[model samples]
Target: MRLTHSCIITNEVKKLSEFYEKVLQIKAETSGDEYAEFPTDCGILSIFSFSLQESLAKGSSLPGSNRNLILEFNVANVDDEYMRLEKLGVEFVKPLTTQPWGNRSFYFQDPDGNMLNFYTKVK
Candidate 1:
């Protein structure tokens, strides 16, 4: 079996799609007005609709606003991407640093505080 797409339940689908498109230079595919997708060479990044009020009413949402997942993007240059995204107003949770395993990496947060990483091999 193959993984087609992974979804992040978000209240602001349009905002997220816009952010990803601008920051990552990705094209989002539209599935009606509720869903947006980023078509990857392999799979796709799908943003699904979520209602905080409904989740709270159903006792599904936690007390806090943050989700419990992080998404990673393996890029060609973590440092370059980090700088470019910083200029685009994407907030970084951690600055890019070289790993002991010889990879350079950094972490950032999405509009909904979903952790994201950009990493590249260190030469």
Candidate 2:
């Protein structure tokens, strides 16, 4: 089955949504203050309020406890993107570097400490 979207559960929906909007350069379609989504070429990146998640499925998921998952995005130029994000004062977990797999990439974290990666394939 094809994946449709990935959702991040957070207590601060507005804050996290705004962060993603700035990083991705896309406006989110929000549902009140409980949910927001950024539609991308691959799929939708969504944020759900912890309250909303509890109401829907109690204790099914935890907010701001992501330690193993890294959301990766493919960009045209990783260096340019890194520079732009740096100017915005984004919290970077790792600086821009070339991977052993021949990808130029960098890692950063959201306000909720969710890890994200932007990378470009070396030609």
- By lDDT, who's the top model here? 2
lDDT of 1 by residue, 10-91 (tens): 7788888888788668888887767889987777887766764355456554322665677677787777888898888877
Candidate 1: Cα lDDT at 65: 61
lDDT of each: 0.77, 0.95
Worst 10 residues of 2 by lDDT: 91-100
Residues forming the 10-long window of minimal summed lDDT in candidate 1: 55-64
lDDT of 1 at 108: 83
lDDT value, candidate 1, whole model = 0.77
lDDT of 2 at 119: 98
